[model samples]
Target: MTYIIGRGYGRALLTPDGIFFKGPFRRRSIPWAEITEIEKRHHTARSSEWWDLRLVRANGRDLAVPGAFTSNRYDHKFEAKLALLREYWQRAAR
Candidate 1:
C-alpha cells in the first residue's frame, strides 16, 4: 500500500511497509511487488475529490501515488529507485 503525500516537488510515496521519498522531490524506484499498486492522481486540494487519477499495482492495493516519481520528472532519476524495488519484487515473485 502506498499513497502520494504533499504536492509536486514535495511529493512522497507512503508505503504501508516503508515510506519511500527523496528530499523535497519525489524519487522513482523500481516498481515493487509489495507496491500492490501505484496510482497517479491529483485530487483537488479540496476535500472529497476523486478523479484525474492513474495507477499501477502488483497485488490488490490501491493507495494514493505521486506523479513526479512515476512521471520521471527528473529524467529517470528514479530509475535506480524503481529498479531496486523491481529487483526485490522479482526475487519475491520467483
Candidate 2:
C-alpha cells in the first residue's frame, strides 16, 4: 500500500499489485507487469511545471501523468515517486 501525495486534487498511488492515478480529466491504472517504463519529460517555457510522468506500457501505449502542482513543484517528490515506481516495477520484473 503506497500513496504519492498530490499537490491538488490529483493523486497517484501504488498498491501491492499496481499503480493508480486520478487527476482532473484522467483516471486509470497500470498493472505492475504491464508497465515498461516511467520517464520525466521536459516542461515547455509556457509551462512552469518542470516535470511530468510518462508511463509506458508493454503494448507500446503511453500515458502521461501530470505532476505539476504536486509532485513536480516540491522538493524531489517526483524522484520519490520514481523510486517507489521502480521498486514496484522491479517486483513485477521478478
Candidate 3:
C-alpha cells in the first residue's frame, strides 16, 4: 500500500520504498528508507495555472524516476493528481 500527502511545491506518493513526484514538471523520487518524515502542504495556484498540489518527503536520498510522460495528450495536471492516487494505492497503515 501507499500513502500520499500534498504540499505547496509538489505531491509525494509514498510506497514501500519511496514516493513519486508531480508538479512544476514531475521530478525524481525520494526513497522511504531515507525519508525521515512526511509533511502536509498546501498552495493556492494562480488562476491561469493548474491547481497546485504538493507533498513533502523528507529524505536525504533521492532516486531517478521514469520520465514524466503522459499518454492521453489531455494536458491536464489536476487529472494527473488523481492518476497518482489511483496508481499508488495509499497505504492502509499510513
Best-fitting candidate, scored by TM-score:
2
TM-score for each of the candidates: 0.33, 0.68, 0.30
- State in Å the error of residue 16, model 1: 14
User: What ordering of candidates by TM-score runs from best to worst?
Assistant: 2, 1, 3
- TM-score-best of 1 and 3: 1
**Which 10 successive residues of model 1 have the least lDDT summed?**
1-10
User: Which sequence of candidate numbers ranks them by lDDT, best first?
Assistant: 2, 1, 3
Clash statistics: count for each candidate:
13, 0, 10
Off by over 4 Å in 1: 1-59, 64-74
Q: How does model 1 fare in lDDT?
A: 0.44
Candidate 3 residue pairs in backbone clash: 2-90, 2-91, 6-54, 7-41, 7-54, 7-55, 10-54, 10-55, 11-54, 11-55
Minimum summed lDDT over a 10-residue window in model 3 is located at: 61-70
- Say which prediction, candidate 1 or candidate 2, comes out ahead on lDDT: 2
lDDT of model 1, residue 70 = 42
lDDT (10s digit) by residue, model 2, range 1-94: 1223443457777787888888765688878888888876666565454566677889998776545323245657667766777787788778
Q: Give the better candidate number (2 or 3) by lDDT.
A: 2
